[model samples]
Target: MKTFLLFCWLPLTAQAACPTLLNQQLPGLMGGTVDLCQYADRPVLVVNTASHCGYTPQFTKLEALYKRYRDRGFVIVGVPSNDFHQELERNSDIGKFCLANYGVSFPMATKAHVVGPDAIPLYRQLITVSGDAPRWNFHKYLIAPGGTTVTSYGTRTEPDDPKLIGQIEDYLNGMPAPAPSVPPPAPPRLKAISGS
Candidate 1:
């Protein structure tokens, strides 16, 4: 009876360990779905990206970061977004660009909405929990192991930023995440124009 009870409880524990924010399967960049839950136990950097954006060059640095820390339980997920009118229309083109130009091996999601009400379920929850949204392509959200905590970095925060690296290392080493950085200013809301 004790063995039976232990077996029943183990699955529940595993399920509960995965963060709700990470319990999503995004359309994979190449094909199929990229299961976020698979990275729940590691420190994963989720960045909203665009193939033609000015910050696109950051992908090179990002790939470097992934190569450096991936062996230590770190992952980086690129979420291509066209909300800013910069991403390629086809996932295949996007994937090819990433591979040919930057050699990005980390997981990447197909084009997604990273802003406003149309944002994907994962991005929506990330916005609500962190009170920050991708203001532009390359905006990043650093989620600690198990999503126990999250920190936001704006588009300009380079992948090699010391503070960003420090936070990642902290998570990998089981250290507490650093305090939230000063968030970017909220975007201006458009007033409804009443017409006669």
Candidate 2:
């Protein structure tokens, strides 16, 4: 009985020690903390965004998808980046534009460097574990309910694209529903840009 109890406790103990997504908390434009761990048990769709990039329009689809599945235990997180020379001049300004233009109500993190040497620690871990990095704006990471990165999609993957949506639905409706309130930690802040 002792050994069985120890075995059961082992995995729980390890999870407590594991670095969770909520540890890196980032402030959202709405003045709230964006903690990935809050949505820990839910499937997350992470996207690197840019305001001026051609893919910027994807925000519309992204938001639509969020509304469609958010109640079903799926979330879409947007991380603004200037790595492609396409983001707004300021992090706050990026928020403003996203709100004014895209009507984006989903959570968004502060602007951060997503590539190169100064990339945020979260992105670094993402790259290391997935063997891929944000190649361009709109690159997506699909995280399973268990906090493991399940898959990655390229820039061409639209937010409502069938392939992507199907996977999310599968995970959301799978055996045990994912935890919906745990969010990951915030990524490191990047150099702030001046609003244009």
Candidate 3:
């Protein structure tokens, strides 16, 4: 009985360890559930990409970045999106285009709506945390280890941008990644004293 109970609790512990943003299993381009939680504790770069977009060439740079940093616990997950109408109609086609054109080997997700009401849970959480949704294809979000923070980059921000690469390096090195400034805590409200 104790062994059976331990087995049941182990699964719960594993699920709890998944970041809220990546708690679900998203469908992969290759026809299997990509259990995102498995990548927990690793810095992940999530890009909303399209096959036919002009920025499609960015895949080459993304693959380069992935290959350069993957051994250091960094991974890139491409989320093929059609919200901008720039993606191929079929997931298989997108997969082929990425592999053939850029030799992309990073994990790719099925075509997903990455903005507004139809956005997937992962994308929604990304927006909620970063306050930046994909304005167009190739928008990128770099999620630091522990998934407590995310940095947003516009579609035009190339994968090799110094600022982006610097932050990724910092995260992988266990240093704090460059972050947006947060306002200091508001001054304590003073209580009014009434003298009768």
Candidate 4:
């Protein structure tokens, strides 16, 4: 009876262990949408960012990480949020500032509220799966290649942290080669809109 019960619980336990943000389309702050399922074969790091925050300089490191590992099937997505304070003025302006000042080349979504009831749906889902919301600027979520939320790091964790880099390397080594014809879409563009 013990053996049978253990066998019956195995599937449930395994299911719980799997990370799940599959097939969800997160809106871009700029002009397109990214379907998380499309990048299931690559690990993704999502960060909640602020343009005028103290940690804004981390954008440079974040860009470097993306450039180094993007070909190895990894990506970093930035989500600008004004949750803590009115730090980010406008979504389009934030994009321009990042590119001009920090040389940021990764995808950045439009500015959105990441902490309150009006949080974007994708972030709402992210918070549910990861069990935490962005407390401040630069909170990072390292997702596994198979779309599982592997770990969540706070603002203090730099992009090049040894442990984080090791985890990314491990995920890269485990990923199978991507299909030949499925190139990633171009980086999202900033939407045309008035300032906030």
Q: Where's the lowest-lDDT run of ten residues in candidate 2?
A: 17-26
- Give a tens-digit lDDT track for model 2, residues 58-151: 9999999999988877888888998999988777799889999999988998888888999877777677777888899999988887676658
Error of 2 at 108 (Å): 0.2
**Candidate 3 vs. true structure, TM-score:** 0.87
Give me the overall lDDT of model 2: 0.83
lDDT of 3: 0.90
Best-to-worst ranking by lDDT:
1, 3, 2, 4
Per candidate, the number of residue pairs that clash is: 0, 21, 0, 2
What is the total number of backbone clashes in candidate 2? 21
Model 1: per-residue Cα lDDT at residue 53: 87
- Give the 10-residue window scoring lowest on summed lDDT in candidate 3: 172-181
Please, what are the lDDT tens digits per residue for candidate 4 over residues 8-39? 99867855544466556677766797666667
User: Model 4 lDDT vs. the true structure?
Assistant: 0.81
Residues forming the 10-long window of minimal summed lDDT in candidate 4: 14-23
Q: Model 1: runs farther than 4 Å from truth?
A: 1-13, 175-196
Instruction: Compute each candidate's TM-score over C-alphas.
Output: 0.82, 0.78, 0.87, 0.77
- Kindly provide the TM-score of model 2 when superposed on the true structure, using C-alpha atoms: 0.78
- For model 3, how big is the CA root-mean-square deviation? 17.7
Give the Cα lDDT of each candidate.
Answer: 0.90, 0.83, 0.90, 0.81
Between candidates 1 and 4, the one scoring higher on TM-score is: 1
Q: Candidate 3's residue-wise lDDT over 1-196, tens digit each?
A: 9999999999999999888887888899978877788878888999999988889899999999999987777889999988988888999998898899999989999999899999999999999999988899999999988889999999999999999999998988894443566999999999999998
The segments of candidate 4 whose C-alpha lies over 4 angstroms from its true place after superposition are 1-20, 178-196
